[model samples]
Target: MLKDDQFWISDDKAKLDMSVIKGYLARSYWAGQRLEEIIERSVQNSLCYGIYRAEGQVGFARVVTDDATIYYLCDVFIDEEFRGMGLGKKLVQYITQSERFRNIPGMLGTRDAHELYEQFEFRRDGDILMRRRPDHMRS
Candidate 1:
């Protein structure tokens, strides 16, 4: 867990609010078409992080790892109402610098937020990132 002023981030899955997560993902272009069941299952299988203010859950990010070599960071977001407050940066920094992931290579995909991840050493490598939209997300 990490704290920044009035906001805090936790990896305890028990603290995540499904409604809040679902609400955001349902509108996310990368996950908009994903089913609720799939979301739940994904959360269960990965290392989940939730950002919160006293009001409630406000941000989220998840990493899929083998507990050995590499990791894939995805589904990262800071609530629309809290976008400029730096919660997203704090969340990414905490996770990336953690003892387990600090020196390990990882990858993340973003169509436009490349600048944010670049600060943490995630560079743009076309070969490292690829895409195949789900059937429903394709036109």
Candidate 2:
């Protein structure tokens, strides 16, 4: 858990405002076309963090980890209305500093926000990130 005057972040998935998460990701380049069931299933399976203000959830991040070795960070976002207030930095800082993940190697894919992630020591590995989508995902 992390908190300040106006925002708080937690690892409790039950506390997540799924509507807020779904709404944001529904329009995101990476997840915009994802189905609600897929979103819910992903959140259920991953270690999730939700950032909130007085009103409601405003940011989110999820990590897929084995509790040792590797950690894949994904779905990171701070609401457009909530950006520029350092909340994104705070969210990443909290995750990177967490004892559970600090020593583990991490990976992520982003077409933007490289600078934001670089601040936390995340760098591009030589190999490109790739995926093999399921048959249902074939165009």
Candidate 3:
């Protein structure tokens, strides 16, 4: 059972068989790959992760790190059906306030989520924002 404030979250994929994860991602425009593969990839890259509910992966957030410090937050997603209920805020708070994340200076890029992250001290600096998506993956 997963709660908004719980650290340990378990989804059906860890126990029973279910396709909801894949279905959710497919509907969300995540390109290719099956549910199990996606789940495996997410698990592999996260320093720590949680899967909410038994049917769907309502949210996911990961830390890109060099182990000791310097962590980059990436891949934050909250299922469309589950948005607007403060779940995203809770997830961000959990990630940034945790002891594991406190010492590390966390960084993330967001299109419209600045308000939520602002509560966690994430500010939209007007100095410099840069990206370099390679040609092969150019948009």
Candidate 4:
């Protein structure tokens, strides 16, 4: 959990507003074609963080991990209206600094947002990130 004034980020799945999450991802360039069921299942299986303001959920992030060794950060987003408020940075900070994630190697792939992730020390290496999704899964 993390708080700043009226905004906060929480790992509690119960705090997640699925409509807000699905609505955002439904229009996102990366996940626009994803079905709600897939999103729900992904959320259910990962450690998710929801960023909220007084009104409701405004951002989200998730980490796929085994609670040890490796972790992958994905599906991070802050509502358009909420961007540029530094909430995104706070979300990254909260996740990377949390006791449970300390010292664990984390990975993420992004065509954009490299500068933001770099602030948390995420970097590009010579090795490529490979995937084996079905042909239909390619976006």
Q: Estimate each model's TM-score.
A: 0.89, 0.89, 0.63, 0.88
lDDT of 1 by residue, 44-113 (tens): 9999999998899999999998855678899999889899988889998888878878766778888878
Candidate 3: regions farther than 4 A off = 1-42, 126-139
RMSD of each: 8.1, 8.4, 8.8, 7.8
lDDT head-to-head 3 vs 4, winner? 4
1 or 3, greater by lDDT: 1
Model 2 lDDT tens row, 21-138: 9999998999999999999999999999999988989999999989776788899999999899999999988988687777777778888777787777776653434222222223
Candidate 2: stretches off by over 4 Å: 126-139
Pairs of residues clashing in candidate 2? none
Residue 119 in model 4: shift from native, Å? 0.1
Q: Report every candidate's CA lDDT.
A: 0.85, 0.84, 0.56, 0.83
Judged by lDDT relative to the true structure, which candidate is superior, 2 or 4?
2
Colliding pairs, model 4: none
- The TM-score of predicted model 2 comes to 0.89
Stretches of candidate 1 off by over 4 Å are: 127-139
Model 3 lDDT per residue over 1-139, tens place: 3465533343223542224444454555333444667665764656544456645456766667774546776556667877886777767767666666666666776665667766777667643221222222322
Put the candidates in lDDT order, highest first. Answer: 1, 2, 4, 3
